[model samples]
Target: MPDTLASNPEPAETRSRASELMALHRAEKLLTVVNVWDVISARVVADVPGTAALATASHSIASSYGYDDGEQIPVDLMLEAVSRIVRATGLPVTADLEAGYGDPGETVRRAIGLGVVGCNLEDQLKPLPEAVRAVEQVVKVAEEEGVDFVLNARTDAFARGRERDPEVNLADAIERGRAFLDAGAPVVFVPGKLTDEQVQALVDAFGPQRLTLIAIPGTPPLARLEELGVARVSFGPLSQNVALTALQELVEGVQRGEGVPSSMRVLN
Candidate 1:
């Protein structure tokens, strides 16, 4: 687990206000949501004046814990990551709490205590109803906490490695999306195999007033998303992977007795 934020001097009022700022980020036009794993990356992202908010990538957190992404890391590790990022920057932070760490209400209660303004909860590992229940529980917690905590509920039916029919998955996702929205999720994230037509279909089906559509990596660009009526776009774990790739290349170059490029070195 990372260091605790209790060591810092930030007050409860400030944390609550930061949560509100994070909630407004969801209503903005074309916000850039970069995923960070630790304090350094979180601080770097916060320094970007235009960055609306920060998101935690579960894969990065898992890797930092010397484990894999799929339920290998403990909930404590995830909460610690959020706490570190929140302390590292004043920017509103949204954590990717994968599957809400099992229990719905307990997860939300824990997350609120950590000072996170928003979170991404997915329906990949659990059934649709279970996911809905989890989202609803989180939303209720957000309401009671007096924070505009944006709950981004993700649907992974398309990403799941199965021979299920696309129509069935789409119907299931749509139903889950509606339930999540009714349960207080402001955004519904669809993560895989989404075409322009399908994106349009979802937007039309859900309606703009009901829920915002969020696309992950492999989806079209920002322009295409706007054209397709997508409200938000996130890269998930791609940014962390990009940083890792750069580090790997730099290390290989050094081992080969080649000096690293000036652009690649951070000379602070």
Candidate 2:
């Protein structure tokens, strides 16, 4: 048997939250996450009646701070932003630690320290073995911290290999996803503007409730994704885009001498 202490090292509350997050992924019900960049967004989503858990969009967070994605923002700054989000709500917060910010283990340790019970660590199409090892390192760190961290191991084959044959990208995603799962991640996150057929292929390969997806344009609807057995569907940076679009339209309307929309709520 596994060492109980090594398997569960978090405080009672923290462990409970982590377990809750894990259970959300394992359930038949799809976990819908509207990724947030800051505390306000976190609070807004958490206030929603059915928001099961919270997730962070690294791209949104970086862009909010006027930095680019791909780890352009400093690690400490990202952690600080995550810390605020974690503190802003009682729900579990899963971060998108893009490629682990160069130190998968250490970054996860720090994120766990900040009350993050889960995270999305993308492979960025690295060599299969190297990416799998990174997943292992993150799982090890989470185990050491005693939290059943929901490692949404992301395979970016489709995202990065758009120029290549669809079959090649699909094969790469399946291979990396299986490797990540074998290495210890609970679910595999495949992000791209994928077709319904491609989504079905992943769900079939990973099995029901074991695959996660990002909701991009042309993606299947939530009901369809749930039917396909996708455990989770997150908006990633697109949530921020929606918010920004509203803001832009509001400003443009104001320039035309129109005031704030009467339908706006004081969410902040």
Question: Who wins the lDDT comparison?
Answer: 2
lDDT string, candidate 1, 1-268, tens digits? 2333444324475466555554554453555677899888887776767887788888888998898987678888778777878777766777888887777567767776777777778788477677777888888888777767777888776667347887877777777787787788877877775767777778787765333344455666777766555666666777887888988998999999988777853522
Summing lDDT over every window of 10 consecutive residues in candidate 1, give the lowest-scoring window: 1-10
lDDT of 1: 0.72
Worst lDDT 10-window in candidate 2 = 1-10
Query: Model-by-model lDDT, in order?
Result: 0.72, 0.90
Candidate 2 per-residue lDDT over residues 1-268, each given as its tens digit: 1111112224676778899999999999999999999877888888989998999999999999999999999999999998888877778889999999889999999988878899999899888889999999999998898899999999999889989999999999999998998999999999988888998999888888989999988899999999889999999999999999999999999999999999899764
Number of the top candidate by TM-score? Answer: 2
Task: Give model 1 RMSD, 1 decimal.
Answer: 3.3
